[model samples]
Target: MVKLDGISSFVAIAEAGSISAAARRLHLSKSVVSERLAELEQHLGAPLFHRTTRKLSLTEDGSAFLERANRIVWEVQDAVAEVAERRGSLSGPMRLSAPVTFGRMHLGPALYPFLARHPGISLTLELDDRRIDAAAEGYDAVIRHGTVEDSRLVALPLAPSRRLLVAAPDYLARHGRPDSLAALRQHRAIYYTNRNVADWRFADVRQDVFVRPPAALRVNNGDMMRDAALAGLGLALLPSFIVGEELRAGKLVRLDIGHEAAQELIYVAHPEGRRASHKLRTLVSTLREHFGTPPYWDVV
Candidate 1:
């Protein structure tokens, strides 16, 4: 029989793309990982990897076996988790990813309390703005903004995120307030470069409007955009979660151009077909409870 440890090492090596990297991820010595791989290959009478000086890749047999290997590992883990749950506790690794701003400002706080409640749970959180392949990256869950397009994942809504057109009082004083969509197009705007930087979309009861405003600054980060707006650089279109505190504190004022900016939902998503471990379910529940319906940040 193939040992589970050998199979796990194979999966790790395949995902990580290198033996040294896999060894580091598994917290095992390179020799130990190599030994496991060698033993598994001997048992199967087939080599699993295409070893090279510059790169490592899976062989045809390895490619064919990968999906089944992943399923086996997950099944074993889920089985262990179910047993642990019946004992009134959970124990496992939970890997997650979220946008940098949300992770720092909100998700960190929400997760820490959950971690405190379940000390046996090992957590790995990656904060990045770029889109990721959830299963390929080995993340148990990912927090996403806007719509989830991948049908292979299950999205659980955490909160409603509404975008608002906003500016500092000082900026309005200098540039004058824009009362209509036409007037708003004439003002300097801070552009979030990650999205379409040239166009701003708005909707009213009767119609939708799109405007192209001259950019005063283009930035990739939401926190920086919020800061630029606060510094009276220019108008900014930002999500409520990022600027809600500033809006409430009178540092930033929402612009009413007779149309509302687009709205989206925050979601905690996981792979579709896999059975969610008890710890993952518990984390999702904690996040849902913490964010509430409208989210604490959006409460007026």
Candidate 2:
């Protein structure tokens, strides 16, 4: 019979991408983890990973093994959680990924009360603007803005947010407000370099669209874009969630360009067709409840 312990160790190593890291996480010695992995390979009669001095990469067989291993591990964990819940408690670590500013400003605040409500649940939240592969990264779920592109993932719409073109009061006073998209060419623009730095998509309708003019100051960080706009560096296109207070306080003015700069649809997404974990489902449902009546950005 395949030993569940050895299989669990192998899965840990595969997910961690390094034996040492897996060992650290599992609180097991590196040698023990390595030995179990070797035993697992022997039982399967195939190499699962490409071991190197720096990193371990899954072989094709390992990748296939990982998919099943993830399910098995979750299933075992679910059984434990089921028993725990019967005792009226939910307990586990949840890994979540989200965009930097939005997570910090909007989602983080909403999650605080939820976390407080569930003392048994621990969270590892990674804040980043870069698109992440949740499955590869082993995230329980990701809080995302913008339309879903990958059909492989299951997406639940958590909220509606919009991207708006705006300029600081000072900037608009100096450079003058852009009357149309064509006038954007005459103004200096602060850009999020990591995002669509050169070409910004805007539309009057779903079918009618065009790209905006290029930017002069290209930055990678969304917060930096907000800072630059606040400092009167240039006009910026930002999600309303990040600049809602600024706009409300009259620090920034929404540009009346008479077009929607594409919608930013917020979603809680995870791997498709996977059995929903109790903790993950609870968290997602909580968010859906918080965002059900359209986010504060819409009203503000």
Best by TM-score: 1
TM-score of each: 0.91, 0.88
Q: Report the C-alpha displacement of residue 225, candidate 1, in angstroms.
A: 1.1
How much RMSD separates candidate 2 from the native structure? 2.6
lDDT of 2 by residue, 171-216 (tens): 8888888988778778887777655433366765432344455565
Pick the lDDT winner: 1
Candidate 1, lDDT over the whole model: 0.86
Candidate 1 local lDDT, 95-156, one digit each (tens) = 89999999999999999999998999999899988777787667788898876778999988
Give candidate 2 misplaced runs (Cα > 4 Å).
24-29, 59-64, 197-199, 205-211
Give lDDT: candidate 1, residue 101.
95
lDDT accuracy of residue 231 in candidate 2: 91
Number of backbone clashes in candidate 1: 0
